[model samples]
Target: MSPYNALIGGVTATLLLGFAAQAQSDTLADIRERDVLSVGIKNDYPPYGYLDENNEIVGFEIELVRYIANELLGSPDKVELIPVVASNRIELLNSGRIDLIMATLGVTEERAQVIDFTEHYVSAAGASVLARQEARFDQWEQLEGQNVCGIQGAYYNRTLTDHYGIRLVNFTALPEAYRALQDNRCVAMVFDDMTLRQKLGEPGWEGYKIAVEPYEYLPMAGGVRKGDEAFLDAVNAAIVKAEGEDRLIDWEGEYDMPPSDHIAARAEAARAVAE
Candidate 1:
C-alpha cells in the first residue's frame, strides 16, 4: 500500500477506535439520558427471535430486551429493536450502530476476547446433526466422513470439523444452510438444538431428523462492546432482577419454552455472578 494510503487507513483506524471507546464509556448514561435502548436481535430464527405475521419482531429474546430497557430507561417502550443475524451483530455493536445484543449469541472463548458477555440468561444443549431419518448416525464418529451443512462464524464449526474430522460447507445465513441441506449438497446439517427442533416441525423439512446431537451445551447471554463497566453493570443487574421477579418464567409460557435454572440462581445476589 502507498504511504499516503497507509496513513489514511491508520487515521481511520484511530478514529474508529476512539468512537468505539466513547461508545462504551458512556453507554449506560447515554441510554438513560436518551431514554432509548438499541438492541440487535434475530428476526429469522423462530421461538428465540423472529418476525411475527404482522412483521413485528417478536420472540423470547425480544421480551428480554424490553425487560433490560425497562430496567435502564424506566419503560420498555424506550427500546428500539434492530434485526440482526449471526454474521454482523457484533460488528454493528462495535461500530456504534447498536447498543447491545440480545440475540442467541452463545458464550465462547474466541468471542469473549472481543465482546463482554453478561451472566448467561439462558442455557442451551440441543446441538444435533439433521439428516434423513433413514440415514444412520449410530455412532457419533460416523460423521467424520460426511459433508455437513453449518453456519459460518459458529463457535462449534471448528469442533465439528477439526475435532470430528467432518467436511463442513458453511453458510452465512440459516436459510442458505437449509437450502444446502435440502439440495443434498451436504448429507446432514449441524446446528443448535432448539433451532433444529423448530425446523423439524416446519413444512418441507420432512424425512429429516437429528442424526447427531450437538457436542456442546452453551450458555446464551447478552453481548456488549468491550470496556464500559458501568453499562455492563446495569445490564447485568437488570438480568438478575428480571430472573428474580419470575419474569423469565413468565416469558417461558409466552414463548412456549422452559425456564433456565442457571439464570434463576444468579438473580438473588452478586456472588461472583453476572460478570
Candidate 2:
C-alpha cells in the first residue's frame, strides 16, 4: 500500500539478498576452515538417503556426499548429514543452516532461482502412479478427477493437479503416504518412479504395480546457496571425479538399485574427459 511502506519492503529485500550473496561467496573456504561439510540430506528416502538396519543413515546419496567430503575435507567422516524433507531443504541451505543439499533435489527453473545446482548427475524419472495390480489406468490423463497420493512440496504436484486434473492427497512424508495407500485411501500413490520401482520388489508390494509410467524425467543435482561459485565448482569437480572412477556404478550395485544408462553414459564421458 503506502509508497513509504513499499520502499521499506524493497530495501529490506535487497539487504537480505545481499546478505545471502555474501554468505555463500566464501562457503568453500568456510567448510575447509571448519574441517567439516554440513549437508542437508533425506534420511527417510531409501536408496538415496535412509536409515539402515543399524539405524545409521546410509544410502546412495549419503555415500556420494561422504565421498565429496573426503575429496574436499580429507575424510568422509568430516561431513554432517542433516535430515531434510522436500519442503525445507532449500530453506535450510539458503538460511545457512547447512552448507549444501545432496538430497534428491531435482533441478528446476523455480529452484534454480533460489539455489545454485552442482552438475546434473542423475536423469531421474519423474512422478509415476502406483496402484493395485488389477487397476487399469496407465496414462497420466486417465486419472482425471481421481484421488492420488503424493508428497507435499514435490515439484510435480502442480502439474499433476493442474495439467492432469488429479486430486492429490498430500502427505508430509513417504511412510504416511505409503500407509494411506495400503489402507486404500486413494486410488493410487504417486512418487519418484525409481523409488516406487524399488518398493514393488519389497515383500508386501507384490500385489501392486506401477500403474502409470512417468510423463517426464528430471535432472537431479546437489544444491548450494546461490552464487556459491567456488564451492559449486569444487563439488562439481568431485562429482566428475567420482564419475571417472566409476564410483557411482559401484554404489548403484551396493544400494540394490537398477542400473541406468544415464549414469553409464556419464561415467563413460567422464573417463573420456579424464584421459
| Number of the top-ranking candidate, with TM-score as the measure | 2
lDDT of 1 by residue, 44-99 (tens): 77677888889888888898898888889989889999998666676788888898
Model 1 stretches astray by more than 4 angstroms = 1-24, 129-191, 199-213, 258-275
Error of 1 at 268 (Å): 7.9
Each candidate: RMSD = 7.1, 6.8
Estimate TM-scores for all models.
0.65, 0.71
Candidate 2 lDDT, tens digit per residue, 140-255?
A: 99999998999898878898999999999999999999999999999999998887998998999999999998898777899888888889999999999998899999999999
Off by over 4 Å in 2: 1-19, 129-191, 203-212
lDDT of 2 at 229: 86
C-alpha RMSD between model 2 and the true structure: 6.8
